[model samples]
Target: MWPYVAGFIGGLLAAGMAAAGESYWRRRRRTKWIPQELQRFFRVKDSSRLQVLQKSFPRHMAPDAKRGLDQWLAEQGLAARLVGVPITESFINTTGLSALMAPQGESWYQVSSVEYESFDVGGDAPMECPKHALWLLDGGDAKLALFWTYGTHRVGCNWVERLRIEAGFVMDSPGSGLADQVLARLEEAVHSGHAYRGQVLSLGGEDDYRGNASGVTVHRLRPVARQEIILPEPTLALLERNVVRFAEQRPRLRKFGMSTRKGLLFYGPPGTGKTHSIHYLINVLQGHTTLLITAEQIGSITEYMTLARLLEPCLVVIEDVDLIARRRDESGVGEQCLLNRLLNEMDGLRPDSAITFVLTTNRPDALEAALAARPGRIDQAIEFPLPDAAGREQLIKLYASGASIAPEVVASAVRQTEAVSASFIKELMRRAVQFHLECRPDAESAIILQNDVDQAIEEMLWSGGPLNRALLGAGEGREQP
Candidate 1:
């Protein structure tokens, strides 16, 4: 009886140990789960949370973090606004904060705080005290802030403790570098210290400004292929500079108005890649989203201004702003308040915020003086004129090289053709491709012949009064020239 009792006890102990081992393995596997944005934000080299947080060291750390977080929230369709100045509508307390929901129809959520005692990776034992207090708000999505200082500054609270309080569950003393990273991201986000006014619309029609244009047709601009864009030396240089600006802007991308956004005015003849270039710029600028608006969307200056201020770090592309905001070649239209709103939106009081304005028109002289006078209103007034001889050659090469056209013959055809915009050339090439596909094996190779290109050009030149009249004549025939 004694031996039987002992055997049963030993068996029970062994079973308990086996169960404990399985539990440990299961916990390890579950801990490996990581959110996609978090993985991208930290560039997680290891599974440890400390290791992941430490690795996110982009130059503009704060903005980068905000962007990462914003993107995740946007994917979830949550509205996130970077609250700058404290607004009467945005309430706060010792534990959390809240803001008035924008774009309407969205409900508000309570802000809460969490204390993470060991988020830091190095130095003695990680600070066990509450490191920071975070403010979480719904902006079409969740936007969380780990602040640096919130309460009683005069007291003998160590800067490290303050940092911890600000950073929430993160490191206490993130140092200037880490602090800057976090601050840069939250620059546009409102805190208790800043001042804010009741947001008003400076421009936009009532329906759109009121967020009621559900079925409105928006001009969703698409980018021309890289091969199709003939980058002249000066334009190429500008493109490179824009790319650098975007790269430097990575961290501050979430912060509205950190650096003045550069707006390019593409004005010239129609089908000159003006619209297409806008899309190209968008593609080059990573993490940048383009919002295309027409004059119809903005009925007044007040509505437009309201939209611009409310939406930061957005590209407001106003196609034919000259129609509404321009001085108006036709007299009575000059007194338009819409122009005032656009000018203010572009070069208004809040120049430091993160909203960019892009306008394109065939006649730039039509724009109002007040609108263009603003120092940074039109950072780079690029004119997308008709392609020159060299530009034409490049266009031909881009269009025909994909096909089996003879290089020398294609070059000759390009030289023979009159000056045309990149858009026209693109149309010509597209037709060539279409014809080639239609006549595939029945016609020799799957290549567009020089003759086919020539025919396409001839058809374009003769089909319209403008192209035919212009090509037949010479001297000052081109608009820009």
Candidate 2:
């Protein structure tokens, strides 16, 4: 009797739900109110029709996309396996002709037995990427699909990396957008590297990884506080205003229809704190992504700009800009080509882009002045001259790290180090401390007197000769006229 009563109640509940579902459908009410699981019971059409969809991604993004697909498929309970096939090469030889690869339409290669490569994903261990992978999902009455992840490498062509999805799904239902769903997930994978939004990245040459196209190195730089950088008050303020403060006001700048994209030129002798100033700027703009490029990496400017545009609110630092961005009259033909590209990249950025370029160089005269004089190319020019007397004293104290030094000796040393770089002060203090240590190794503290500093200067300037002095930035400490 109890069983009969339960059955009768279940029948009534099902009937009532079916009637309500029909009414909701006819009225077109917001269907989201209905729980997906509850609706699944009523709609039970098994997958039947077969279809395929495919799309290509940038070569650099292929490895990342595969990892993303792996995680997603695992969550969906799909079974996958890699199918490694031997790459084949067919070469035609003639009596007078040398053996050559068949064609893009037909060519083969194998550095190793397999083409699986390991990519560094900014983790303790690298992720393994296979040449080809096939995934199968047999969800009986729900999902019947196969996914393929692979890349295509043509000898001279740029086309690479493709994701293909083939599925047999419930045909033409009100929902069941399988193709769109997979693509949406793939899009997530392709643009998910560099760890986080605000990271320091550099484009490495194609020397390390065998097959990976974009050798992106994640830089974990220590953040520097303002106190650490010893710059003139005005110069420091200019830096803060141009980069840090501007980055902070990106939202307001965009709202007012002003171009947040800007460029900065830093020209001075080497070791004058240009690089150190950039480090401080990095600290202030911790929320922005920074990309560092050496002059040798100018060939990858197109890739770097793409990244800058993708990662907005970005900082691009090109060290020794004069190497490529030289005055047209002084630069060679090759240098001129690169200079044009660099200028074009700067000028082409949208006014709304929050990208800042900080270019450093030792030779200001070498610069055609194209970057600094141009309106859109460079927003501001900041000179990193040799430190003044006051800065020299601070640097000495800073590197000395609370050593026992008298005020008179400090003043005298500062005078002797005139027209030298901040680096010179740093090196001088190091040598002075060494001399003091040699004389008083077991002393309670480092007591660097006038004689100790004088001896160190003599070794650097006079004993070492002109070349050594020039390299060390130990300018001749002649008394003023």
Candidate 3:
């Protein structure tokens, strides 16, 4: 009984709507409301009547089209004027790529049909269509489509149905595979150390993530990891011992005052591959989060305290502590404050806290005496002195073993250099090989010649000796000026 009653009601409602629509259509069809331009294009032949009716029609029909067109039409005394000039300009630019206007005796005819267009507005610039300009079609409508191109190009036209395009021309659609790609790309950027300055995941409004290529580069204050970079079997074994001890024993050792927090201070000559070793550590310690901070980042001692305290459960690296942690009296009051702040933060972290602080310095002696005195403050101080022959050979292998350098040349260069850090040796090899290659671009591609290595060594012996001497002197001295 109820089902029949519901069906009867629905049928009556449908019939009433149909009757109303039919009546409205009949009335509208009989009404004399033809547009002048349309009538002219159709060749209605009643030009005088249309002109009279058009002249009487209000001048402000298309608000966005009227400004420029109204002026033109007013100047020409057209039968009807178009409004909304900016909107119309955008409409024409987007839809027709170029709108065609034909003189209809008393009015201008718009020949093209309306089309949707969109522009991706994030990143450095907006996405573009060659012939079409994307426009805002729905002034009052919430959901808007954007796309514009000259009418002939059909390829980009179909993409207008997608909701939005994220950075790098990626389109996003609901329940679609492409949307997943966009989200995954964003997640990769975030996880791979790209810091989000803005809400990047949300696509509701215009703003997207804009930041440095690798998020924030905290000026690493310490060696984020051990910097005594050596490929020697003995050195590797020693490092492995420490790493194994830390990984395996750290958990049990925590109760006996041994901390899960590890600190390695690399005190050695410049060019000892201290920086390179840190990079290697960052690469190896994949599971753990790391933050690199330098002394230069400590604007005032106060800011250092704040940053260090905040970025906990992370590796805080101080790159050159010989410059930053110098004795307070040896430098300015500002330097003293910075050293103090660093000291406080280093001492402040709890024993079991996840944060690991690594400080690197060429001159450990120049550091404030008391800074290193705090027990458990600096758990281990590993030194990276000038590399021995074996270390040099390993470094040469690492640096020049890339597909570009010839293996024979790498061996010859490694053997010739004396007592230089891995860094200096690599620099020499890089410069010498580059010079040799550039000098003989058309020559057979092969190992860097022994002659090239000798020349580089000679150049460094004469021209570079002074720089090294100066650095050695500064390392031993009170301060670097």
Candidate 4:
């Protein structure tokens, strides 16, 4: 019985050791086989070894880069030979003893590539991709081979799609010049602003802004006209002169020794027309790109600045800026660092760069002194105060332009809405229109009478309680200043 037990234990130990050895060798062979297969498939000659250049990009931008590079190669009259290699679950699972002992004809690289249609959220388009592809281009004097693969990148617990590109050339070719030309073309294709024009880009990512491609969500913005924004004449004039004029006459400003990059601060209560005014600006500057960064995305402020520089004549809007630009000493180290980055980026802008930094905050006192107190950083600080009687009247009429409200009703509502914001007036007009619609649903030409306006004003201002006033952006009329 003792001999039988000893023999059984020995057999178990041997089996475990054999399995471990087989596993190690399988992984080793699997890793070595792919590169060997790539070399053989390309028929890389003994006299000419492969020189490789590699780059990685967010999966979203990879297709664009590949297409751009392919187009560029075709334009240069280079013939492209494409070979795709499939990576299947069976291949991955068999990456042990089975892989090592597999015949050359049965290798993973020999498998025919599978193509799939990938949906792009950026636009209404579907792109095609294989699991992995190698592109060979004949550059007359030099032969270039490009390889691209798609994979998942784990960022913390989140998985992000990533694309890796590797380019190989003959060792005897003009390596530096050829590589630079290819890389320069790729860079231009990747950074081209054609894709982001007339769209609002919000910063994305956990800690850093990865520029337009990797860390951004493109928003299609609806253009607002000048008449839609109600502000004091002087404030409108200031915005036109400082922001609009700066963008329009950037070259002229640079020629005159004036800095083309201007920073404008909009400080006021929540319900004022600060953001509305920004929308108007966005509309007027139709050709230029606009970047909208919320307080939560302030961590990517530096990245936003970099993009602004690249996309010149760009508007960088930072809403609720006081969240990140708090006084240095009173804030945490991270907040202070963010404030410093903001100042540095603003200061580092070239005079000829037509980049406008538009920052808005309800609390100006909470901002860092270096940002607001400095002269060069903030070129203009425009206060967006609550609309006075005249402004409110104009806002009511403007918002009620399509409605059947009379001028007298608007005038009456304006008189009662003192210290209310342009937003409040707009909401009042909206409620009045709704009331009229409810009372006379079948009346296509129903008029919004003074009684409707009066009822809306009373419900929003007097009877609906403090919460209603706050919700409609009426209670906070005065700026802290």
Candidate 5:
């Protein structure tokens, strides 16, 4: 009886193992079989009775559009079926060119399934939903369907979608009618807005200039207020009139037969207010799209110009323009090529086009003559000179707004900071405050003393020697005229 029981137990264990093996094999077979099933569905031969509709979109948006499109189809009261195919590594490796091609005159192709997690409202664990290929059931009436797959184009690994509208014989001109409908939907989606609004977009990758056309890297920037900037009254007014006013009165300018397109150049010593003024201008023109191109991105200037044209009523801000637009003789062939492209884009723009180019440079003398010499290429060349005594006083007050600094102390500091840039005044105020806070950490409010301001200025000037003073816009070692 013991031997019989042992044998019976062993047989039961063997049967259980066999069932598990069978289940595993069945799953593997189904994994391989799905693409084939989709391919077969794609090759239906009754073209005379079927109408096809197709459209493609970027891969990023395909998955997002699925739910909305599915609901719309259901609301239309059509029998719709949606299937997702997973693009497993095994499938990609084994699939051949013949397997990917659609039947003659048909737009269907096998796509890999991707799985996304769906969450329940009760904070339950996520459930996996597989989506690979989309199918619209053909039951007498026309059906709308779409599928997502990798694009065949050489423009990098982008997602492509093929949308279809299949109707049985009742519709005449399915292509145009369906295309119009698709366009209308697309227009609505675009008008709804994009995720990159009010964000800075920089060129991405080395191939950006080589036609790889990968999208830009976005950066969110904090807006700088006008009062936060310290510039000469005339300089501020000039920018307000040309840059801000021009953008606002663009339509009016065109009405008066005036060219709305303008170019501005800001040149001065490093650490001056050129960049700060730009920040202020960006804030002032809040609604307008602004594209910023640094010295490193000069290679993709042409692409930036194209984008500026597309995003009209835009500002193209190029910092350190002298880096690329250097004196032609001093520049290499490549630099010259970039400079020419820059010149051509500026010159080619329509007079009435609502686009402005604001370029800044520290070394104005290094810039190409063609860029600055031409009247229309740069309508205004504003110099961001070292701040005057009054400007320095204002800057000190601005940066020290929260601190307890008397006006007399600021006036004295301004006298000592003659020929200093706005930046130096800012640093001077910062250091003075730091000394005050460190000494009076337990005080209700810190009062910045005259001694603190004097000490900070003395440290900056003497610590780094004359080179530091000159760099800080103190104009050290210059002949006192």
Candidate 6:
């Protein structure tokens, strides 16, 4: 009976040991799985012989970079496929994206991402992009592995915590130099492939204002017609010749060894058509990408210029430039630094680059003398002065919503708006129409009477007070300030 019991215990112990050994062996096989697959795919004896090269980009641009890489690869007639490497959006190995594909030296595998990080990148729908992914790619004689990770981030944080887009290429170690070549092309693609190209965009989001690092927001501006801008004939022609005409003559200018890049200053009081004229230029330069940088965003001018180069035939609108253009000596450290950067970028542009810098400011007297004296920085400074009686008449007629205003009535309103802005007249016409419609809603093309125009002007100039007058673009409103 004792011998029988001992035999049974020994058998049980052997079985348990055998099971444990098998489990360990399976775990080891699973660990080697990805490396073995990569080795076989590259037709190399060892995984160490494979080289992994990578590039990092701003996190906000990760999705764009991925799109660029894919677009560039597709253009090269190559596609990447998975080789059983796992993926997850939240998981990131400190070494690199290689951990998801073929870890460089020491690593583990994490997998399965059914979700994508997506958002509107100048499109109606959000752009869907992989948060983490690995792929095996073959381009004729070149065999490579591609790894991408959205990288890690902490909310409201800077780039310190790996806030970037990591893209890597793994290939044979002898160095076919293929990775470097592909990376160069990929970098260009990332820049040119930006979805914001040929679209109206502005930098926003981050308080730090680190160029593209801050983030991009798209804006939709309805097309403004050539007839819509209300500047005087001389001012209008000068603007068209400097901006639209210059663009058309880019090739000829470059051929003649002249610079295609230009900087124009639009100086005037508020609502005198500086911004309105820019919108017209945008419509005229149909193929150009427009970037609007407010005074607060001036810090990112350098990055904006880099983008302008990539998306050439670009219109860069800088509003209230006088804020930075104040005499540098009188300026604080931060202000002086920004003004220097702005000047440097404007001067740094290539002669043949097709970028037009249009800067707007209300106080030309407050502008830095250096900025005005700088030759290339202000190729032309067009004034956006308050309209005279003739220009005012045109503005009133234009904004009247096709209402038949008696010639006498228009003449009266134009005289009253002598020193007011094109924008003020635009609002005056709107209020006049509202008054007409309120009393005559059923009438088509209601006649705008003198009373209607006068009442609207009273409401804008008197009822709304000084703040409202300024808000409506009224310049002093017949009062000396």
lDDT of each: 0.48, 0.67, 0.47, 0.71, 0.64, 0.74
Residue pairs clashing, model 2: 327-368
Task: Give me the runs in candidate 1 sitting further than 4 Å from their true place.
Answer: 1-228, 239-261, 300-311, 434-445, 467-481
Among these predicted structures, which one has the highest TM-score? 6
Better of 1 and 2 by TM-score: 2
Task: Report the C-alpha lDDT of model 2 over 1-481, residue by residue, as the tens digit.
Answer: 9999999999999999999999977754432211121113224322123333455554455556777777676776644333323333212111000011112211221112335656554546656665433333444444433333344444332333333333323456421464466666777777764443476878664465444434566666777778779988988888888888888888998899888888888888888999888888877786688899988878778879987876777999999998897787778999988888788888888888889999998988778777767677877888887889999888888877767788898899888888888888888889998998899879888888898999998887778777887899765544323
| Clash totals, every prediction | 48, 1, 36, 0, 8, 1
Evaluate model 4: give its TM-score.
0.77
Quote model 2's TM-score. 0.73
- Comparing 2 with 4 on lDDT, the higher-scoring candidate is 4
Please state the error at residue 116 of candidate 3 in Å: 24
Error of 3 at 241 (Å): 4.2
| lDDT tens digits, residue span 173-198, model 1 | 23333334444444433221111111
Residues 210-260, model 3: lDDT tens digits:
322111222322343443356556655655555434655665777787667
lDDT digits (tens) for residues 317-434 of candidate 6: 9999988888766678888888888988887888888999998999888888878877878899999999999899988889986788989999999877777888889999989988
Query: Candidate 4 has which clashing residue pairs, if any?
Result: none
lDDT of 6: 0.74
> What TM-score fits each model?
0.49, 0.73, 0.49, 0.77, 0.74, 0.78
| Higher-ranked by lDDT: 5 or 6 | 6
- Model 6 weakest lDDT span, ten residues long: 155-164
Off by over 4 Å in 6: 1-47, 57-68, 71-95, 98-109, 119-126, 138-143, 151-181, 191-194, 206-214, 402-404, 440-446, 477-481
